[model samples]
Target: MAPQGMTEAALTGFRQQLTGDALTSGDPGYDEARAVHNAMIDRRPAVIAQCETEADVARSIRFGRENDLEIAVRGGGHSVAGMSLSDGGIVVDLRRMHTVIINPESRAARVGGGATMSHLDRATQPYDLATTGGRASTTGVGGFTLGGGSGWLERKFGLACDNLLAVELVTADGSTVHASEDENQELFWALHGGGGNFGVATAITLKLHELPAMSMIMLLFRPDSGPEVLRAYRDFVESAPDEVGGGCIYLTGPPEEFVPEDLVGKLVCAVLITYAGTESEARMVAAPMLELAHAAEMIAELPYAELQCMLDDPAGMRNYWSAEYLDALPDKAVDAFCARSSTMIVPSGTQHVLFPLGGAAADGPAHYPLPWRGSPWVVHPFGTWESPADDERGKKWVRDVRADVQPWSNGAVYLNFIGQEGDERVVAGVGGDNYARLAAVKAQYDPDNVFRLNHNIKPA
Candidate 1:
């Protein structure tokens, strides 16, 4: 079947010009093609173009514009707002284009736009080279890095965007463009954290660093010890070397063999200490937290790729997440953060997390739009559940946490960690000055705002 609004002849012509498959409403895998990471989003696009190459992406974009249909870009289908899918529109699905090429000599990797963190990490692990990536292994590298990527290694190596070496994109007019420090420098700056508002990234090249050994210390404690434990964790992180990174979190104890039977399915306070070194060094650095009483402990040195998948959330679950960056984590602020855990929906996959920033991330390029990089700490409330009945409650809990932390908020947000809040929040994520400059770039590359599904930067 042809697309809903497109004529049969036009649809056939577009399909013939592509080296990929195009699916319509009644196509064999139409339903599967439209599915994204967040189950809460249920949009049906008029056509789904599974692009296999950069040329396919250009053709799909041109086809969508010619047919007067909204165009959505899909990379791992992980946008929390379901921006990857659109109702009665055209979706450029890039999952088929996922490919990673590693260059050990230059310590760099060129990743396909649709590749996931797992794809990037697994490819680089063999070479003992790695870069910053999202906390989840299944997150799209394009969306995550462009939206100011943050991860367990951010403090040590800076954000994923900081590692960006170059990008190959398909513009609004279906023209190919490349951006790097020496070529298309303005577009290169915007791509750091400006997001998909600029264009469709076909591939991105990232700088990698040698990571010989990585270790982690995970300690689970009773909820009552949250205040003291969080305070200690904060102090330890403040004085620790940049090689140390992790977070203090409140989560439902899992059924893993390491967790005690009694704590399973119950709320617990946990502190995860990640060290970019061997197990012996990690143990010595995390000794402060080890001295405290804990119900369960897991300490070992593992491959970086292995650690990236340890907390992977299963797909198809309802997800709503928000974040607040803080200039400080004072005692009172820590108390407020822990107090909100009482309202969290227990026995679920939700996590109330506090991540420390301010190492290499703060020292990175200041010209980029990521204003949140300067923040010393961040509180991210990740709400994931399996039922629609708890949607309202789960969303409310996330909002309540944001409100509780407002007293210390730095007013900067990481766009990747949030859904569609509003336009003002978009301005706050990127500084007011940076937003204007990004708008200018948008006008030059996408004057009509063809790519507006993301944290939109309207043409000037």
Candidate 2:
């Protein structure tokens, strides 16, 4: 049993059913098993069952149901809210099933649910094949794709959800089914951008593309020039072609080894660039950004995966994120963001981004269950802190950033970035119409809502 307490007999019975590692709260690995990527979270689940195969996932699901225990499925455990654990329940951890099968001839890869972006990238990079994945190297492909992954290649290709070819799911009844275009097409549709409400996906097949050589540019401008900088960014996004994908980080200077110590905690604006063309083209593409104002330039040509790691935050940092999809980045909105951004506290820990999402993401008439499509840009306010005492400060910063963008936003957010707000935010993630349809599908496949923990979609 867990810290809250369960009987030894019940725990032994559960262990008997598990072929993979079964860690209880009393075990030596207990504290580490309960720890998620976000240090802010600390929950004690009764069972931390790491599944080795699809059968293990199925058995765990049934076991949790039979025992009347709440279930939390964890992929990368990178969630800011730490929704992958309950007070005293079963946690079906998918970390042990890290496998990526790449078929270069077909330009597709079948990945285990536990595989991280780094795992998939390492497996596919040798062939120069890539897919729509998260920006961070360690983010879980499962949670990111399930919530409609948006990233550096989104405008060139599409949402990660759109690239899904098929998935192996363990339904509420413990039956395993393959979902794709022909077999269970309805289930396939729900999987794209539906969050993790439908079922537990043991494996996913994704379509990959030949990645062209890319050059990224990193520029930092003064805080006073934030408004002009953001305005220029908006113009660049509006006029730039699909080949260019990048965003700006509004934060203070970080005390990296290369940066001077005095500039470490000062408010600054950072603009990052990643393009789908050659270095020559990236230079021309980055010219306008240079003209914005006086600042520092740390841009260069690098491997696609290398560029992804350049922005990685320090490990063990507490953070919260909120997002809004914009139809257009208005001048006033740009000014508003710049105004508050200059005053951002905690300097190096705060992050603000404007994700480019158009060309490919909006070009398709794809039948994804999620309502969001055709959005011009996605804005995320990523708040982070190294100290535990800064918890409320970080939370308030995220909340305020979200509030500032409300006027220009369309309300629907990227579910992957959302925290444990409430059902209202869940309904807001997928619009009312889409939520209803998802609910109906959920009722048909999972009437009891065994998988209701994630941006939960209750049965209709």
Candidate 3:
């Protein structure tokens, strides 16, 4: 059914104004159109406008407002909290707008709002150029970059937003605006970590760097070795070069060729070291962990794009994850982090992860709202399972991890790593003062809070 305030004639007129197809309830692809990355979210938007152009985005926003309907924007639909979909509202679906234009000379790429990491990576891989992107290829560049993107290469190239050159956005009033260092300066600053509380981004231009080669080291150890392995990993990463980037995770061993049959389907601790250069350089830098006893290992140089897909979590799984940035990873803390691994759901896709953040990430602009950047390490309890029966257990394990590490927390977090934690967490996500400033910018661009589905910032 159409929203209470919307009539069939109005819906038809709205659909006519779009160059893209609109999917409503009972539409051929409505079910698929409304589905997001998390299977836990099941919402039915009144109209799913698969926008093909910026004009379509503007029209969809206007139609939603005119009909007193909530407006949600869908890009890769990767929000763990399912913020991209609205129940019985209008959805500005930009999947059809996935286009990437690369400029080798300028060393940049103009990515459509709906473009995924795969779209951006594949386009720039041929040129041997790249930028910081989400770990998953299916993640939307716009949402990831705007929410302060963190990925495997963050230590090398910094977060995705750090590479942002400009953004083309359609405001709540159905008008276009361009933000960059030289244009709409305040709004541009907010885009660094403020998320989509301002407007719908049509296109984003990102600065790219030359990436000649990439390599990785994957070593699996017994779950009991987590504390010792993490301690060694911590000591090595403290002085590791900027070219080094990766994470340590405790996950259910996958049935991979490299994984021993005894370890498969069992709780195992793995350490991954991704190097931005050649295999030799990666091996020399990772020599410390190489000497440790291990059950299995894989070391090779691969394409940067290929490395990004290696750890891709399959979609349509139940996911509940949270993170805590730490001032330091002391041995006691490592013990606590490792101990929580026992509580995690086994034989599922869940992972207890630890990512070291420093290098280029810590060296990036300190003025941005990403206060967590300065932290030396971050503990992420990434819970992804296949069964609803495990939902309560999965969510509790994530919360427990956060609680376990509270003693070392820097009191700041990356909003992109969490769901709607709370109003207080939102304040901490973006620094207290930064939140005030972001709200002022929010007031200028979206005073009515038209884009409140995300970690919302009320207009000042």
Candidate 4:
């Protein structure tokens, strides 16, 4: 049956106008095209327009609006809340637009809106250049950067938005526009952390930095030692240099060769120290965590691109994640974080992670919409499981983690790290003042709020 408001003739005409495939119910590739990274979200959009170019993106948006279909944009399909897919709307899929062009001399990369961290990283790695990218390889550059991108290299380079040079976008009216330091300046500022509220980004230009080498130290300890280990990790990060960045995590130990047989499949407290320099420098900087007794260790110098892929989570798993930015990581907060690990579904992909933000990440432009930049620490409960039965258990664990550390919370959050939090949180993600300004920008570019699937910023 044709979707409501979508006639067979109209659907066929829409397909004829696109250079890419348009899949709908009962279509050959419809199911696979609609599947997002989060297994829990199984929405069936009336139409999934696989856009291959900027023109295609504009056409898709116009078609959705003209037909009164809710519009969702799909880049990497990694939105934990599945905002990229709509239950019965039109999805403007940008996966086919994944292209990366590097300017070696200028030290910049013009990345396609649909490109993933792996795509951008690999393209720039050969030139010994990189920018802050998402923690996972599969994360979409569009959503990540637009939502204040964070990652291992963030402290050294800056959040991904800090490196943004320009963005080519398709606005609500199906018109193409460019946002940069000079063009559409207000929209550009909003684009820093405003997310996909204004339009569909067809391409984004990011400033890159010279990254000659990258190294990391991974130390695994017994779960019982989490409190003590986290305390020390906290102190270490407080004084760690800009080149040093990583996280202390409590996770189900994977069965890797370096992982001890006893620790595998069990919850373990592990500290990862990522260094932008050599292994020697990394070891020297990470000496504090190295002193702690560890059951397993892996310290090596590797390509920057390879390091970016280390935390790649497998797709097709149920996911629910939330984060709390903290003004400080007091000992009490440390204990609360460790205590909550017990509730996490073990033998699953759930991770109780604590990342420090300082140096370049916090030092970036203060005028942008990002509110989490100044917070020194962030407690991220990234819960991933394989069963529907664990849905409540997983979600509760994430929310409980947020509640546990609410005392020290700065009330600011990174929108990309969370999923469908209320409007208040959306305001908190970007400061109240910034939200008002972003809404005005939304009013100018998307007054009707055509793009509302993300952590939405309503138009003024």
Q: What stretches of model 3 exceed 4 Å from their correct place?
A: 1-3
Candidate 1 per-residue C-alpha lDDT over 271-328 given as tens digits, one digit per residue, 9 for 90 to 100: 9998999999998888888999889999999999999999988878999999999988
Model 2: lowest-lDDT 10 consecutive positions = 1-10
Off by over 4 Å in 1: none
Q: After superposition, how far is residue 303 of candidate 1 from its true place, in Å?
A: 0.7
- TM-score between model 1 and native: 0.99
Q: Candidate 4 — which residues are off by over 4 angstroms?
A: none
Model 1 poorest ten-residue lDDT run: 1-10
Q: Note the residue pairs that clash in candidate 3.
A: none
Model 3, position 104, has a per-residue lDDT of 98
Q: For residues 47-93, write the lDDT of model 2, one tens digit per residue.
A: 88888988889888987887788999999888888888877889899
lDDT of 1 at 65: 97
Candidate 3: count the clashes.
Answer: 0
What's model 4's lDDT at 434? 88
